[model samples]
Target: MTPFIELFTPVSIRGMTVKNRVVMPSMLTHMASVNGEVTDRLAAYYAERAKGGAGLIFPEATAVDDSGLSYFRGLSIAHDRYVPGLKKLARAIHEHGSRAGIQLGHGGRYAQPEFSRSARRLVSYLPGISPEEDARVMDKEEIERLAGCFVQAAERAAQAGFDMVEIHGAHGYLIGSFLSPFTNRRTDEWGGSFENRMRFAEVVIRGIRRRLGPDFPLSFRLSSDEFLPGGITVDLAAKIAAYVVHCGVDLVHVSAGMIDTNRFTGPPPVLPMGWNADNAAVIRKALEGTNALVTVAGRIHDGDTAERILREGKADLVSIGRALIADPWLPHKLETGQLKKITPCLSCNEGCVGSIGKNRPLSCAVNPRVGFEQRPARHVENARKVVIVGAGVAGMEAALTAARLGHAITLLEKDSRLGGLVNIAALPPHKDIFLRLIDHMSHELVENGVKLVLGNAVSAADLKAMAPDVIIVATGSRPVIPGFLKNSSAMTAADVLSGCPTGQKTLVLGGGLVGAETAEFLAAQGKEVAVLEMRDEIAPDMQGRARAFLMEELSARHVKLMTGLEVRSVDGNGVVIVKDRYGNEYPLPRYDTLVAAMGYRSEQSLCAELTREGMRFVAIGDCVKADKIMAAVHQGYHAAKAI
Candidate 1:
């Protein structure tokens, strides 16, 4: 028997027989063309995941109508002109031996006005629009047209050789808006009563069924619990699920949360794994004896957890969303009994969600080849001898990549440990998952025969003696102390995370990701923590959902936050601060400890030394730029590949 018996078991939906129970649920990747056409990049992205051996590969939510676009580069199926490009995508996935599926959705009131030309015109005619205002509501005629649009999109999917089409009624999309009372305030037939609210979904499913017939599989993605006040409840969602199943829906994909509220949609590291399993179980039980297959997606990253969820009858199938982004070969690795080789998703949202929020192409922190699926590592005709300084994420990645390509490699770390700042990052609450990167890379270095040296700092003289063909410096970065706090007894954020003792009252300088997280860490340890930010907002670099959750946690823990405050000078007892908004100076509450979280400066001394010695070396990661893990790992991967 397979180790993940339940997860590896094949399941049939309608006439389609999926190879396994693993479902790659829909996640928006802004890889399509600006005009909403399915580009080659998008096709390659899905094809790679399909090649990774997932049973079902559902592409990101494709807009069913022009006004339904949520992002600038969202894929669309509103016209027949898009059919050819979508056919290419479907064929690519099918060629990789995975069942191809597409999610059809309408953003409705949550749609981005800038993405739709019509939306911009409508906005111009309306009163002053606040950023927080809801999107323009569609009238009865528009709602009917959207239902027809879904049917046409499903028909197009059938033409594209897709095995299934999922109606995206989750994540506060168009159909979801009609289902939730929080978004639908209309007194018309589309709102008010529960049955009336679900009328839009019922119409969509019936229209698609009528167009595609009974043989084609149709899946419905629903938010079993909106997780917001006056939003759709679990019981209400179960009722809707029963109604949809009765209306000829073949599968139910359960999820939770609204995009506007940011209450759910993607669980960050702060939330426990399988946070929405109970919601799926409720709907699954509600739809018992029905023909629909129930699937749940919410932080079901690992095979063990996915298997447990299936074995315990939580749902019929499990959806691995972001986990697939981190390592597309997760399913194949699990089936081949190489579970340790699978890269883990840290749920940091730094690359995937964060990039999407920034309107950039989606990538992964652990996996560098996420967006560039068409390009694989080229084989070297003659491998070179390589030496890497530092065993951090970047150094480990460089060594592993170079050694995998038949190069002789040696990795050096000044510390006794393998992970650099990752060790400090893992010390935070619910962030231990980051240590897996170090563990995986260290194992790969040994498996690939890369020599690793620890607790020994290598200098330019040492490199000259070795005479390496190629060198990579990933010495990482050091914490920066603002000049104003130079002589004061201020400690770096690393010190706080490394178990430095804190007093009853602690003042944290800097309100970026590091500082905010450090403050939370101290507050968790029962310290009275106060965060001081020179900027107007705290954690400006953090993703929207993550920042919201972190602020709420800080508030719950009674951590004081003082933003727009510039430090005048540091004293022995407390620091004097000036409000940047006004010119008012004030003395804050007495704080015994002052921790500096004012970001980092690149450790470029070694790089400068290598340059002076005229060594053939390249600097990657923090040694070149003090950025996030995404930049470091990406640079390391590419640098080694280039060599």
Candidate 2:
């Protein structure tokens, strides 16, 4: 047997044989055409992942009905018109020797109201819909119609040449809502007792099986634990799994949480790796002696962890979601004993999930070529000598890209290390996973033969001496201290994070991602920390789930949060803040330390000098604009390609 026996081993279910145990579970990319049709861009995205050697490629959650749509450009199988595009997608996967599966889902109550076209609006959508209104509750007719939609979608998937179909009965979608009493509060046969609540799922599964026959493979994705009050527990999910298997589901893909509860939807770095493995194990044991295969998803990034889960009988298959996004060739690398070459997912959620939330095409922070699959960089005939200032995320990415394109590259950093702000950002609690990116990029730089110059600042005269063909400025940014507080004896958040001395009590001046994280870092160090924000909420820039996790951590540490407070001025005693509730100005209690976490400003001095000299140069990352890791990495990759 191979070293990663459990992970590399093939598994068969209901006449379908997967090449391995590595499954690429459904993840929405929002790259479909305007009419919810699969475009070439979407097909290329899945084809790339399938080429990476995953056993089963389950494309993103596709809506079975128009009312179930969640994203603006989400894929759909609502009608026969979508069959051709889906066929192209299925062929794209099959050509790469991987089995393709489509996840049929209905957003249910959590579905976007703007996208729903059903005559009966979900009760959660409007204020006027009362319990007595037949439109509010899914009547028997609507339930039958919904089940028929699932069956028809499954048939279309089979027609599209898909090897299997997955019923998305998780994440508080329509089927999941019916399974949980928390969302299904109806007095009909679909609600009340456990058997009644599961009736909808059983009906849908049996209907699909009746239409598609038992020869075709069918998988059911379930939330093994909703992780909310009045939600389905592991025991209930086990029973549901047993019932679904009896109803003809060949596989059970175990996941956790619902959309209403953000934390469990996508567990961030703060949560432990393989956070849902225990729940999956419970369901797997419940289905023991059955023919159903169990697959688990939730931070199962690497081959080691995936193999462990299978070897321990926790799950039969491991789903790699964001990890495959960060490195599409992850499975191929793992199989070929090139595990060190794999770029791990940071779980930052700054790009993948965050992009979807903002109604944009999904992209990866580490891998910028995600959405732009058709536009790969072509090797230049005449390779130019490129000089990149600042060995930060952007600078390193630019250097690596240029070097890969046969260009001579030099990466310069004034500091002794690489990873400019990332080094400081990773110092916070539960954020050490971010350092993996720096390590991966650093290794790439050396492998790609990019000249690395550390602890050396480059000047305009030095650039002239070097005579580089093109220069990329990624000088990064500096923390901003409001002018009103500059004169006060307050240190920037960077100083505090970089091991500067701090008093027992510290007040963080901003409540964005940086400020909130800085406050948590200080609180973890036994400091009495308080965060003041001008906005109505804290960590407004962070993803919903990650922000919730951070907020909970801060609360557990007793860190104070003061939102909608404008800082007036800072003095030797303390800072003066104005409450936005009634425009009341007051002085905060005396505090020994005042930390300025009020975000950053671009450092464009080098870029300005180069522009003034009429040098062929491009500015990327913070020097261009102070944004998150996504913008910086994307800018770097494109700038390098342009050069």
Model 1 residue 114 lDDT score: 78
Per-residue lDDT tens digits for candidate 1, residues 168-221, read: 988777788788777676687888888888898999999989899989899999
lDDT of every predicted structure (CA atoms)? 0.86, 0.86
Alpha carbon lDDT at 240, candidate 2: 89
Instruction: Report clashes for each candidate as comma-separated counts.
Output: 0, 0
TM-score of each: 0.95, 0.95
Error of 1 at 355 (Å): 1.8
Over 4 Å off, model 1: 120-136, 483-487, 573-581
lDDT of 2 by residue, 21-81 (tens): 9899998898998679999899999999989999999999998998788777889999999
The lDDT of model 1 is 0.86
User: Candidate 1 has which clashing residue pairs, if any?
Assistant: none
